[model samples]
Target: MSTSDMQDANLQEALVTYEKLQDIEDDMDEVEVEILRQQDKLCKDIYAKRAEVITKIPQFWPLVIEQAPPDVDEYIQPSDSALLLNSLVNLTVERFELPQGDPRSVSIKWEFKENEYFENKVLEKKFWWRRARDGWAGLVSEPVDIKWKEGKDLTGGMLGLVQKVWEEEKAGKEGETEAAKKLKQLMEDTGLGGVSFFAWFGFRGRKISAEEDKEAFQKEQEHRQARKAGKETEEDAMDEDDDDSDDDEYEMEIFPTADDLAVCISEDLWPGAIKYFTNAQEQDDMSDIDFESDDEMDEDEPEGDAPANKKRKA
Candidate 1:
């Protein structure tokens, strides 16, 4: 065959291959769209069912409270003063599929009405089935991470306590190791440690000023009065200085957990904080629960080439 004719034939074959690839991509796109629609319908149905069940039951809060992890029980303060009773804005069970071939996971998230301080969020116990050949066997829940609203920023006090604890741990003080472990766990769970912390604050650290502390206390008093009067003011209405974004010198990134909040206010600060941290950690040990997900199982697995195949790191 002539060289020109051979070249033309090769070009025609390449065009055909390109067209086929385009057709496959189009078909895959259509399938993905259909899958999304089905997922949307399923989610809506699940939400509706959940709402109906809760609405029908007058003792819904009690059931939910009972289901809460033991560690959170103290923080929940199930008595009349408990925020869960009045501020529980939402409770949802949402299913999230892992990368294509992996099994899906359903997580229960509870969001309380945001108060003056940090936003209150709770990730309820995560449950999953073990990989087995026969009938379902391994059914358990992981320790839930709960973030409580403090009505004001106490990050400075918490950070101070953290530094004090670190110094004690360095000095080989009694019970410091156990306290350190609990602190580490809390930090890892809440993304308040190491690189995550650096990412939020960069090289600079935030410390609430004396004046700001006084202001915070004043706001708390006002907040309490507003709550009592049943007329909570919008956060923006409280003060123009409330914007943390404009403060170029120090940016408060991580907020204190409920446990940390208690310790910060305690007279013995660091010692009390360590005790609170250790107690919460001990609860998980006695409970015999594993919170780590399946994706977090094999650390030595070869990394996947595609985003869908990649395992998320803790």
Candidate 2:
């Protein structure tokens, strides 16, 4: 081969290798970006899970501990403790306890047999607690072997279970405290145990009675009716007063005879009465009192104008 051809071949090979390297670098950059995004998403999910578990642990622990069977009959004498302890031991297997430092880190295992349907189940829950400053914390947990049986009266069934646990704990077989026994008994006796644990823990609000709503509605209606009746009575009284005034006006009379209707020749009312009488007589064609004629232009037309006097031949 010629020297120039060999040189050209080497340059071409170098250019192709450089382009391949750039492509590989771009691919690596994309992969790294995607990996970072995935990591961020995973961390967020973990934090969320932890937060939920932490929030639930404190609330769940108290109820579970409270409802557990009692270990000793602290109320009864020392001799009776053995009897109660024996009864508890015969029915239940193990006792669950809240961890000392962080509640979220607690683990619980409960094993029980369902004699009604002849089934055995073991429930286990694992938790992890992450602490923060100012007493804040997060938790992550998983539950295993929790079952949803068919045809179960959910409320009644759960209450029954808690009641049974309470009984066992009361006998001291389930390793529950004396306080727990008391709480369990109280809840069961008050019919609160039949409620879902979440509801009992204040997750839900209590319902109001229909009677209360009806009573409130009736009160509002009565108030409205009373106001309406008062308005109607006021209107009726006003109408009655108006009718009385009309009757008084109808009974009043105005009578003016010709003598009483005579016009006095006083300056104050003379002009008005003269103008009125003149207009009236003119309109009625009564020209006997011919004040317009010079013959009747006397200084006084008597006190009031009357019928013309008849004069005999002079």
Specify the highest-lDDT model's number: 1
The CA lDDT of each predicted structure is: 0.41, 0.34
RMSD of each: 24.8, 48.9
Assess the local accuracy of residue 77 in candidate 2 as a C-alpha lDDT between 0 and 100.
32
Q: Residue-wise lDDT of candidate 1 within 162-217, one digit each (tens)?
A: 44454663586965455455544555566543222112111112233335544654
Instruction: Put down candidate 2 lDDT per residue, 1-314, tens digits, no spaces.
Output: 89999999999788656655655665685586465444434555563554465454333322222222222111223322232222211111111222223222333333343422213354433334332221222333221222334543223343334334435534768455554455445545655422432111111011112344345445534544544444321111235554564343222111111111111211112223224434544544434434345355554467678745643222
- Cα error, candidate 2, residue 220 (Å): 59
Total backbone collisions for each predicted model: 1, 6
Instruction: List the candidates' TM-scores in order.
Output: 0.26, 0.19
Q: Which ten contiguous residues of candidate 2 have the minimum total lDDT?
A: 252-261
Query: Which regions of candidate 1 are displaced past 4 Å?
Result: 52-110, 114-116, 119-314
Candidate 2 residue-wise lDDT at 36: 40
